[model samples]
Structures are given as C-alpha cells and as structure tokens.
Target: MNFLKSTYGAMMLVGLLAVSCNRDEDMQQGTDTEEEQAVETSSEGEDASDDALEMAYQGEHQLSVSGGRVKNTLCATVTNDKVNKIITIDFGDGCVGPYGRERKGKIFIAYSSEVGDSIANRIITFGDFFVNNKGVTGTIELRDVSINADGNLQSTKRLKDLTITFPNGQKVVYNGSRTREWLAGAGDDDPTNNKYKITGTVTGESTTGRSFTQEIVEPIIADWSCAAQGNFARVSGVVEMTKLNGYSVRKRTVYYGDGECDNVITITTFRRTYTITVDN
Candidate 1:
C-alpha cells in the first residue's frame, strides 16, 4: 500500500510539471506570433504612406510668365512628383511685340530632395538668350529668392545686379539670405494711420573680384484718409547704402500705385498713378 501511494504522488508531480511546461511554450509561441503580426502591420502602413506621397505630387499645372520684360504668353507644367518642371515660351503672335520674341529661349528647373526647401539650392537651368549686351553661355544656379510661409517676395539681388552685367565672362552669385519685418501703427503721433516700417540686409559676392554688403532700414507711411478716393498720402523714412560698394543711394518717395498698400513694397524708379478702390 505504501509503495502504491508513493507512485501515485510521483505521477501527479510529473503530470503537473508537463502541464506547466506546455503552458509556457504556448505563451511563448503566442508572443512571437503577436510580434510578427505587429511588424507586418507596420510595414504595410509604411508602404501605404509612401504610395500616397508618391501619388500626391503627380500632375501638371500651367505656369505663365508676365510683367517685367517677359512679354511672351508662355506655359509650363509641373510633373514627376513635383521634382521636375519645364517652361516653354511661345513668343506668341507678332502682335505680342519684340520682348516676347526674345523669350523663345528654353528654361528647365529641377528640384532635389537633398535641398531642404524648393527655393533653396534649386537647380534652375537657363538656355541661350541675348538681352542688351549680356549673352548667355552656361547654366548658372538661380539663388537668393526666398518664398516664406506668407508667400512674400524677398530677394538679396541689389539694384545694381538687376541692371548691370559683369564685363568679365564670369557670373555674379548671390549667396546670402534676408528676412523683412514690417510694423504698422507703432507711434501714437504718426499722421499716417497706415504707418509701417521695413528692415533687412543683403550680402553677396561678385565674380569680378568685388564683394558687396547692403543694409536697408526704411519706414512706409500711408495716409488712408485719401485712400477711399483712389489716392494715397505717402512718405518714406528710410536710408539704404552699400558700405564698400559703389551703388545708387536709396531715397524716399511718395506712393502712387493702387497696389502699394501692402508692406511688401516694390521700389521702382518709375512713377505712375492709378485709381485704387479700397475693399472693406
């Protein structure tokens, strides 16, 4: 009887041990299966995300070049994940004039992901063109144009660069950046209720062994009392000059255009008056 009882106890212990081992193995297998499932789900999600991103930028949009010396009614398309864009100039019927005829040149722009922003480090390839005494040869990178969150136009290209070309074969390069801040209605005694100010600087180098640094500090004052009648009472309190370079002195002028109400001012030597109808 004692031997039988001992045998029975041993069998019970063995059975318990077997059950525990089996449970542990089942738990481990379950954990491994869950881990694999999670990995598969994550991989699928990443693939879907990549596919969506790829599809989001595939399309074409027409681009037109107007204003300035660009008289041609050109059109272009944005395609290939927005990485490649091509612009073609039609020069339009002869009625479009000579400036349009000159725009028959080709332009290609390519974007790289390595570059942080589309405006920075972009490769803008320009083709042959004859404008005034300037002749195009090789493709040079277009730099210094900044597109901020607000889509304001800010560039470091000086007035001299806008008009002058290097006598040497080399091209002038703009390498610096600028930020402009405008403040309106800061002073209580200010007469112009739409009083505002702008401050920024531009620094760049020339291939002709010359360097340039310019500082801009200016206030834009506009009287909106006359604004209702398509007129503006304006004054500019700003001074701009290049410390070491020979350039024209920045002077103040009265605002006359209909589109001159914004802080994003376009300083031009030409003076023109336009009837402005203010919107509520």
Candidate 2:
C-alpha cells in the first residue's frame, strides 16, 4: 500500500505538529512554564500511537498463523490469529526506525468482526509499548466504520484514558472522540494520495497539572500526498485549546496554514500570536 511510502514522513511530521514553546520569545516570562513541554509530549505520544496503529492496519493482511511478518523500518514481527481476530505487531527489544526513533514492545489490534462487515470496529491496545522510551498505555477504539454519503469511508474514534508517560516520569492523560471521514482517494489503493477530514474534541490533563479541552473549530484536512513530498500532512485546520481554571479559561488557538504543505503554523493566544517554523 502507498502508506508504506508515506507513513514514515507523516509520522515524522507528527512530531513537528506537537506545539513546542522551547523558544524563549514564544511566550511571556513564566506563563504556564510547563505547558509547552507538556503539550508537546502529549501530542507526540498521541501521534506516535496513531502512526503505529496505521502501520499495523495497512500490513495486517501480511500476518498469518505461521509466524508471518511484514517488512518495515521498525523490523517488527507480525502475527495474527484469524480465529480470534487479533493482529499483533511486535518490536522486540528495541529497534531504530525512521528518523532514528526507537520503539519497543508490542501493539495489539483486535477486530470486533470481519473487516468487510457493515458494522465493525477496530480496537487497539498496547503491551508495554514504548516509543522513544516513553511508555504509552490506552485503548483506541474505532467503531461504526462505514462509507458515508460522499462515498468516503467514515468512522468514529474513541480514545479511552490514553496515557503517555515520559522518560522523566511525568504523565499525561488524554480522552476524546473524533469523527474521521476519508475525503479523497478512498476508492483508490494509493494511500499516498489519501486525504481525510477530521473533526473532534479532545480533553486532556498536561503534565503540569493543567486541564485543557481542545476542539477542532475547523475541520482538519489531512493530505498524505503532502507528506509524501516531505511536508506537513495537515494542510489546513484551526484548533482551539482551552485550559480550565476554576471559573476562568485560557484559550490558545492553533492555525495550520492555508492549504499549504509547508511546515509553518500560527499559534494565537490572548497574549499574542506567534508564528512557528516547524522543522521537517
């Protein structure tokens, strides 16, 4: 599948998508000091898990009961139980994958029913999974998978207590539901040209003990072709992240560029607007 070519780049860009305020000028002095790092880690954790799941899904058919395997940068060994509808991707010990990222442990993909079934679900769970040494635990459920009126594949994704524990021992908990619709290239077998329209709301608590709700005010357009060209996968979208504090709220909005493939994004908070140049 074309995902084999685009998955690496897309996952690399996911690292950049995580907002990082490491730069001193990005925010006021000592304003939510830990917020930037916390958000960055959380976002990275979420996307890493996503990247792994996508990989497993694309190569699922390659696995068999006789110790079948799928060849990829991660050097993972794939196995499955057709009777039980479970697919397992195991990255034994530690393996350096694309961009020198090391992953260890296993990912479990369980199907509620046949993949072609009208009403089926994909449940993803982990077994001591660690990406870049950060422990990731949680269940990601993709339920009600079906084709929409527009001839696009659509699904409802529920994240239940998705937690990421950083190497520093700090942890972040994330929960949310997202609606994903394959806006383009669903009929085609080339995943590199695939595009998706994602709308969702995520609630999470950062390592700094700050609680935030992130809503996608504008539908996110994810284009894999852009990533195939070594660019950001997210072409356009607007996300509002509001931190709740007693009766007050602090809002920070992120704006992906206007259908551009460049690694540039604008982050706006009540304090100021910061233009960030992401590293590809």
Instruction: Give the residue spans of candidate 2 off by over 4 A.
Output: 1-30, 35-45, 61-74, 96-102, 115-119, 132-134, 166-171, 185-190, 229-231, 276-280
Q: Which pairs, if any, clash in model 2?
A: none
Cα lDDT of candidate 2 equals: 0.68
Model 1 accuracy (lDDT, Cα): 0.31
Candidate 2, 1-280: lDDT as tens digits: 7987799888777766654433322333335435555444444455455455455554453442124455654467777677998878888897975334577888888988753343478888899988767787898888878878977789987888888887878887889898988787653445466777889998887775566788889988877777557566677888877763321367777787789887677777665676666433
> With candidate 2 superimposed using the best TM-score fit, by how many Å does residue 59's alpha carbon deviate from the native?
2.6
Clashing pairs in 1: none
Error of 2 at 143 (Å): 0.4
Estimate every model's Cα lDDT from 0 to 1: 0.31, 0.68
Candidate 1 versus truth, CA RMSD in Å, comes to 26.7
lDDT of 2 at 51: 54
